[model samples]
Target: MTNILVVNSSALGPHSVSKALVDNTVEKLKLSHPDANIVIRDVGANPIPHLTADNVVPEPETDAQKAARSLSDELIGEVQVADIVVLGAPMYNFGIPSTLKAWFDHLLRAGVTFRYTEAGPEGLLKGKRAIVVLSRGGFYSEGPLQVLDAQEPHLRALLGFVGITDVTYVRAEKLAISPEERESSIAHATTEVEAVVNQVSAAA
Candidate 1:
């Protein structure tokens, strides 16, 4: 059975557009693979502690550091075992949420998830697919604002660093612009999600 990992990084909880898109995508995936195991980690609700000196150091760490390391291990383990990863990431200040960044910090471990090679750094975890659902207040999919949108590029770089190069993005833009814009954005995203589902189903 396929092991699917869903990471939610929206403080708005159920009201988040990213979460809604992810939920719809996951549901479609389930229909395609009934036996797939889905695991969810809500980073926004239970934020991961930011990386600190104690957590990075190997000797004589504090209790908080130990806890942080443990959580990091767990997060890495999830990524290691997942066949497909789904991220519900909303743009915050033209970037990803700090909670999601903290999660990425834990997963990007040296000698574990990635290591330096003669040519460059090589990722250890291979053969995994990642799907990112992004919700934005402004229209950053294209045009001048696209240059300022760092969320998708950051996620792609970080995930690629960990060997997840097959990444797809489903964007819902201009969500806060107007009621009509919000509806159209969500509808377009939903269509994209369905297309992805159909593609995955066919591949399966």
Candidate 2:
């Protein structure tokens, strides 16, 4: 049975385009693999605390630090057990949201998710697939605005650092441009999502 973990980090909550895409994707995955175990972590709704010196250092600390550590363990445990990870990452100010960044910070643990070797730092979590659903106000997949967009590339790099190299992206862009453009973008993204679902189903 496949274990899927869905992580949402859109401040827009129920009205978020990224969340909608992720929801569609998850529903398709369920259709394909009815026995799959799916878990959700809504970072935007319940934001994880940012990493502090106390939490990182791993020593005797206050109650807050202990709570943070426990949460980190739960977050990492979920990733470790998941066969596939789905992320709803919306661009904010040309970058990723702070809520997602905080979750990433907690997962970056030495001698756990990654470790420094003689050559360089090597990721320990391997053989995992990731699907990132991105929603952007402007076109950033290509053209002049691409350089200014840090959301996709940063997520790719960070996920790859944790050994999740098998990654796919479904993007809904040109939002906030016009109602027609938003509709077109969403329609295109929905098609892409269907294609992704077909591919994953075939693989299964």
Candidate 3:
């Protein structure tokens, strides 16, 4: 069975566009591969603590550090075992949420997630495809709104650092302007999600 890891980073919970996208993608995946193993981590609901001096102080491991490290290890293990990863990232101040960044910090350990080689830095996690579902209040797909899209580039850079270059980004933009535009944007994004589902299913 194919193993899929899904990360949902939306503070809005069930009402979140990002969560909706992830849900739709998972539904599509189920249709394609009923036997697939799917694991979901909702970072926004159960927020991960940001790294601090205590995390790297090298003293007796505190409960906070231990918990943080444990969560990070689990996340990394999930990625290592998964055949595909789907992530939901809602833009915050033109960047990723603090909770998501915290998750990244924990997963990105030196000599574990990545290492420098003669050629360049080699990411340890390989043979995995990642899809990031992003939602924005304003239209930031292209052209005039391009400059406001820090979410896409930031996610790509961080995931790429972990050797996940085969990544797809599906965006649900202009979600807060009007009811009509929101619905239309969501429909368009749902179409993209279906396309992604088919693509991944075919490859699998």
lDDT of each model, Cα atoms only?
Answer: 0.91, 0.91, 0.88
What is candidate 1's CA lDDT for residue 33?
83
Which pairs clash inside model 2?
A: none
Candidate 3 Cα misplacement greater than 4 A, ranges: 57-65
Span of ten consecutive residues with least summed lDDT in model 1? 53-62
TM-scores of all models?
Answer: 0.95, 0.96, 0.93
Cα RMSDs, all models = 1.3, 1.2, 1.7
Q: Model 1, 122-178: lDDT tens per residue?
A: 999899878899999999978999999999999889988989998789999999999
Compose the digit string of candidate 3's lDDT tens values, residues 65-97.
Answer: 777667667878988899889999999988988
Worst 10 residues of 3 by lDDT: 51-60
TM-score of 3: 0.93
The number of clashing residue pairs in each candidate reads: 0, 0, 0
Task: In angstroms, give how far residue 128 of model 2 lies from its true place.
Answer: 0.8
Candidate that scores best on TM-score: 2
TM-score head-to-head 1 vs 3, winner: 1
